[model samples]
Target: MPDISPLLALPGAVAGAGTTADHYGDLVAEQRMLAAGRAIVDLSDRGVITVTGPDRLTWLDSLTSQSLATLDAGQSAETLLLDPNGRLEHSIRIIDDGVTAWLLVEASQTAALAAWLDRMRFMLRVEVADVSQQWATLGQLLPVGSPPLVEPAAPNGVPLVWHDPWSAVQVGGWQYAAEDGHPAAEFPAVEILVERDRLAEVGVAARAGELPVAGALALEALRIAAWRPRFGGEVDDRTIPHELDWLRSAVHLSKGCYRGQETVAKVHNLGHPPRRLVMLHLDGSDALLPGHGAPVLHEGAAVGTITSSARHHELGPIALAVVKRSLDPAAALVVEVDGVAIAAAQQVIVPTDAGATAGVPRLPRLGAVQRPQA
Candidate 1:
């Protein structure tokens, strides 16, 4: 199994579970149950960081792209950390519990994000710590029953539940998708924090069928179906928020200056992103799904590569890819998987004219003489 899931059966998923956690033995059923809000995803392997003190909110506001100063307690917000040139460096899922702001990130991002925050705190009264050792995370949809089987509690007085904000655009955000039929509304996901010591308890409950459990495979498929963009999966060195339709939630266009703000602003106000995100519906006749980094080709020429690929229970083989913004939206394409070319039809997520939101008009050329009205 790989980092995603045995649920996907990408390479060895048919034999072993993927890299993260348990395979749960029944991926199909897991997908069905999880999508229906009857199951929970085991995300204990992810990372958790905490920011403390009175200046935590204000300090964070000055550093990240989102307006965090006014973030209310128990509220969910997503923000991006980009380089000076506006390329994605980190994606932070934030939930402030009044006293402490809990930063949920991929396990691989814990050390780097903590270190960056630590170095940026000059005189502000703030403290950052990677508390993954003490805390764990679990994901699920809104409860199917009247009452949730597991209630999230904050032992430290800060509520531990972080409702996902990807279901809709956030304040000070912009959306680039030209259509309104996005399935994001179907993904009412949330993350809950629990003490690491409770993992054994949760496992026992799951094993006894008192609660349902899912794996990365089941969870990721639902994400693809919703056309959601993730951190490590959908992001790359050249990635900017506009390219992924990430501005819908992870970016604040009007927020004051932060690292990469210039590029974000310029791209949205005067230019289009170099690349755009799209969902590829792969041919499933072979029952073989392309893995990450698989080549997307037009006329046998490489145009882009698949970021994340999965075999969705309902949608079959699907993937997210970043292709040239100039690629024709209606052009037929193909994805290469393990030396075989799989037919792929694109479903546009971000449009070619995604940016230039400011609508700046073009000026006449400097060397060209002004012409009279024809």
Candidate 2:
């Protein structure tokens, strides 16, 4: 986990007594600011992989599910790394600094992914290096055109965009990016390292100038509303990228060969994905539901399992579940937590037909009302 102690001094950071852990130190303080929307989270827990050398673009294109050739210096994309069986290995954000490319992934998977990439470098002329510590990352959702130099791409087909300090692209929404120092000759964005203690100062500066600091919980809520699946929670070696509705943002059907190309094309063109990811509105408490592997039942029969859960103050207990695709969305299901059946209503957030099937609603806008439980 990223060190968030720097956030403690920020206004409205901790609402109560804070605790420290071996991994996630000062989580209580982080959670409090996250709940109240008054702090900016240091997303340095995300690992960064730098792809340099002349053959970087071609090398990456042949290795991932997305089309790397289309990305320019100021653009970014969400792509997936798949296993031999087309199972999800990682969900990554690909940022191009004009010359070199950077891959951002969950911290825990950094070493494994780095090793895997290194092993696959058969005379590709690409150098893969871990740059996680050399740089710091922060994310915030700003209004369209709020930042002067930011490129935006809505990978999930939602209103939100991935903003960075680059020439802005007018996708569905606006995203802004800012770097600390001058970017490399090929990369256009500025790159700088802000000290941990200076994050609050940056936040204060941003707010004073009209930019608001959005915490992790709020970002998670935004992701849930957009139906974006997290890697560890909704994706794993047991499931393919299509099962998690990642095809829209991560996997490009038209991309060239990669590690899991065969299985991906086979399931996509010929077969239906067995399990599907769905959003659930829990009826009962504001507390979070059991996380990954928790059972979901219908009339005492096992139906599916909970993958991720969060306590949204406005939405009560909300969760994401990977259930049998054949199960009716309107059907009432129960998430079994500690032998207790917690009522959960399902909503198909990502339509397999990409809006051709009109059963599910589109991603909600910021501050939209929660879907009422039946």
Candidate 3:
């Protein structure tokens, strides 16, 4: 949101044009660069908040969805800040450096989230500051097929990095995505902190072929293909982590009390999420792309709406949608884009049966005292 025009005016690159792109001319080439893990994306649209104080870690653990009280230096985790009524309010990508906890959030949420955190620091030794104006965000992928998990080293004197944990379930975390061969297992994503003043330098270096640079568009396509959940797009005020399969990495099931923890436990253990997430493989052979909020239909009835849709180089146009949990998994669906119906097939990311103790016994109905004879 700062004066990034200088960065955009560099040669051989196309302007981002709002909420998309930081690419160097060719979209396909930029996408290839990202998929190969050879390019960095200028994710400056994200914001950073710094939490400094002795009580930072413990205080965060007591208020968020993830357990952070024992987190060590340079470690990463994703946590959700839910309302008291168990609805999502914010999702934070977090990492600590023993002295500071850096929270990476959407730019729109930066100041608001920081202000809220400050207000909640009653009688606590914690200080929250929106550092987005001082720091920027950059994204890159870890080495493909690397056996050991890698942590991103600070770049350009910026000393924080938050590695994405969506690739697998963390200890004490629950996974609502019941499908076999989850696509995120291969999404080796990492986000790094960078000084704001280095933006033009990065753009210049990228233009001179000294460093590879792509755009947010490429990364988003891969994210959709991988079925990753994101804030502002995949989430809303009514969203619960279980609906997005976010429990896999963000919610620690056995963590001590926090806002919305009761709803998380009850939904996972005894009740089912009211809705479910699914990947829609759209019929884009017609070159039609569906926009966000496009209706997803089954037999002429609107069952859901497209949250995020993208045209990946390899996968073409694909989308992620949230539909009623009772919608039949095998039912053929359609997405309406520009008044044309695009046929879609459901890839069961979160199955209808997703929940803990799904097979647990249930009590008999109140009016039925005895079993009826067959």
Best by lDDT: 1
Which 10 residues in a row give candidate 1 its minimum summed lDDT?
1-10
TM-score, cand. 2: 0.72
Model 1: residues with Cα > 4 Å off, grouped in runs: 1-19, 143-148
Ranking by lDDT: 1, 3, 2
Clash count in backbone of candidate 2: 11
**Lowest-lDDT window of 10 residues in candidate 2?**
182-191
Order of quality (TM-score)? 1, 3, 2
* Best-performing candidate as measured by TM-score: 1
Writing each residue's lDDT as its tens digit, candidate 3 over 105-166 gives: 98778878999999999999999999877877788776655421213346323357677999
Residue pairs with colliding backbones in model 3 are none
Model 2 lDDT, full chain set: 0.60
Report the C-alpha lDDT of model 1 over 77-176, residue by residue, as the tens digit: 9999999999999999999989999999988888999999999888889999999878877888764233344677686676688888889888898889
* RMSD to the hidden true structure, all candidates: 3.6, 12.8, 2.9
Q: Write candidate 2's Cα lDDT for 226-303 as tens digits.
A: 455788678756887666666655666766688898887777665667788888888776344676789889888998
Work out the TM-score per prediction: 0.93, 0.72, 0.92
